[model samples]
Target: MERMDGVPPEGEGLKGGTHRRTDGQVGQWRGVFSPGGGLQPLLPPPGPPQPLPYFVRRSRLHNLPVYPRLRKSNRRLTELRHVEGDIWALERELRAFLGGRGGKEPEVQVNEVTGSLRFKGRWEGELREWLLQRGF
Candidate 1:
């Protein structure tokens, strides 16, 4: 039988490969070369940064607030969120007024879901006007 050398043949295993041993213990490959057998770059060099879109650039330059969800909503971005908040405040005020905290006595119960005030009494002159002005 013929004898072969310990060195691997070309293209058969790691190219330019070398190993170290400590106390006859052969250490694994710790070099940075790619194991794929090629010297190609791991990643292509990054390209120049892209420019922002017109609206995005403008908003950023002006420090404008962005409302992403408002575009899909029924309201415009220019509209404030205070409409519902105003309604809620009016409901609280009406509840207080109905509970005799507003120096007026009226038989009325504010609906929770619809926020409508139902008058159980026939005295509807002043209370009706107040509720109507508050959009209830």
Candidate 2:
């Protein structure tokens, strides 16, 4: 082979790492021997961005009594929903049957012996006398 600086070229360097020709020619390996082409530097792959999480609050049944007006207002406000094939409409229609609206206060019924106060309101199938017995 040929002498590159002080080191002697291996007899068959093309089979190894040395840049040399097989025919004892003095050319550096390259320019032709590589079938697929030249070496390329390794690279990293690209990826998607991280996403954020979503959250929500939960509710429980104990809070219903805290808003008395809201609790009572549900039926009055949505009177139509309470009506329909059901008997709620009948209850509303018969509300006037409860008594006269003479005073601002809701009608009160007091037991003669027990003296307990009771509020009365109409129901779907119950008789009219139950209101005088119960209170509103």
Candidate 3:
């Protein structure tokens, strides 16, 4: 590329690449810019996988829930990956708790159109209130 002075910009350096004739080893990399341009590492290298929460070592109830149960009344709880305890898991846990063994427990059907989770049957606002209190 021609410079404003009509000379190829930075030709005194690499012919078009960064390296020293003394050694083929990589020289100072150019444009080590970060997301907002700082002298920090251009990109963070892959880090070790994060360890699971110590809560996992506690009782089963302390572990994360399968997903955040959004009730018909509208509420937001901890992420689906971090929910535990409270009445959020009740609907799905009931059949197992009662040993219904009818080969089917209540299922929560997610509405594809409205993005809502509905129970196989209503709990007379019980489930909705419980989830709301816990921000589910």
Tens-digit lDDT track of model 1 for 11-76: 442233344454665444311233555332223225643332111111222222212223444522
Q: Give the backbone clash total of model 1.
A: 0
Q: Where does candidate 3 have its weakest 10-residue lDDT segment?
A: 52-61
Which regions of candidate 3 are displaced past 4 Å?
A: 1-104
Q: How far does residue 94 in candidate 1 sit from its true spot (Å)?
A: 3.1
- Candidate 2's TM-score reads 0.15
Models 1 onward score TM values of 0.23, 0.15, 0.22
Report the C-alpha lDDT of model 3 over 1-136, residue by residue, as the tens digit.
5333222243232222344434555444333223353323222225643332211111133322333445557753322222223323443444353236344555554333332334444342443344333333
**Can you rank all candidates by TM-score, best first?**
1, 3, 2
The most accurate candidate by lDDT is: 3
| lDDT of model 2, residue 51 | 30
Residue 49 CA displacement from its true place in model 1, Å = 48
Write one digit per residue (lDDT tens) for candidate 2, span 1-136: 5344223333322221243455665553221123244332222224542231211111131111111112355531111111123233333333454334433333433333332223343222232233222221
Q: Return the clash pairs for model 1, or none.
A: none
lDDT of 2: 0.28
Better of 2 and 3 by lDDT: 3
Q: Give the Å error, residue 10, model 1.
A: 97
